[model samples]
Target: MKIFKITGEFFLAVLKRTAFSFLDLMKIIVPVYTMMTILSYTPVIKFLADWLKPAMKIFGLPGESALALILGNFINLYAAIGVMPLLHLTPWQTTTIALMLLTSHSQLLETSVFFKLKTRAIFLLILRLSVAIMVGLLLALR
Candidate 1:
């Protein structure tokens, strides 16, 4: 009976922690997704698309793909994925974007983690961003 009580308490604690973590993630994802969706319907997206077109061309991606990159970097990969289909990306473009995000997604959250661990947050941020850009450019060459 004591063992059963301990097991039940442990499971309950795990469940509660998981739920809180999910809510924390949702707080970031939902707002970013909502803003991206709203931006898709406005001229702001077009302006950003046009502004980023030249840089995106270097990565063989459409200008609109900038939103995914921004969201993936600042928010999370899920936020990037939420915005991807709206851009109508080609397979290669999608692959390039995925690679970039995989290399350096969730900048703010990850940076905080680095800081908590007594690591150099800015150095890691720069390194990750640089590596992501280089990998993206190389993938574009293929």
Candidate 2:
């Protein structure tokens, strides 16, 4: 009776919330994925790879690995993973990228979250990116 009505309302609320959250995630993921796909077809990715090759060499990764790092940092780890196979990275390179992403991925999303918490987004971004690069450099030395 009353219990059933309350349960139904609760379930409906949960469903609505879930749907909205999914939409929010899709808003971020789909556009980035499409852009990355288009970039793959263009020479832009190649140019970026060449431009970043020297920096990437420090991490023992191919120049193309820059795409993964850029996607991971600006978009999200899932976006980076989606772009990864296209680059045909080695196992070591994959591991290095994974570690870097672990330290600093989803910059826009996480920065917004941090901002809502009254924290300095730029500081957090710099800290995470610096730590990620340092870890990559250390791993490359091994």
Candidate 3:
């Protein structure tokens, strides 16, 4: 009976924490998703896409996947992932972006931590960003 009560309490706590996490993600995902959808209907998206295409071609990604890379680096990975579905990424493209972001996501947050550590944040930022790009290009070439 005691074990059963403990298990029940554990499940309840997990459920509560999970609900809050889901809500937090919804806050980021919903707004980004909505903004992307609205932009998709405008010439703004096409313009942005056209402008980015040359650079994004280096990673074999569609121009709009640039949004995901930017968001992941500056904001967080969740915000980036939110836009990917609308981008219609190929499996290879998705893998490239995922690899890139894995190396360099949440740059602002990490840079602040480096500052707090009295470390050279700019050097670290350059290193991470360059490594991400190199990894992306390597995968894109495969």
Assess every candidate by TM-score: 0.76, 0.71, 0.93
In candidate 1, clashing pairs total: 0
Give the higher-TM-score candidate: 1 or 3. Answer: 3
Better of 1 and 3 by lDDT: 3
Give per-residue CA lDDT, model 3, range 1-142, as digits (tens). Answer: 8999999999999999999999998899999999999999999878988999999999999998999999999999889978989999889899999999999999999999998999999999999999999999899888
Task: Name the best candidate (by lDDT).
Answer: 3
The collision pairs in model 2 are: none
- On residues 64-122, what C-alpha lDDT tens digit does candidate 2 reach at each position? 89888888888788778767877878888889989989999989999899999998888
Q: Candidate 1 regions off by >4 Å?
A: 1-34
Winner by TM-score: 3
- lDDT (10s digit) by residue, model 1, range 1-142: 8999999999999999999988877776677778878887889999999999999999999998998999899878878877887788889889999999999999999999999999899999999999999999999999
Provide the overall lDDT of each model, using Cα atoms, as 2-decimal numbers.
0.90, 0.87, 0.93
Higher-TM-score candidate of 2 and 3: 3
**lDDT value for model 3:** 0.93
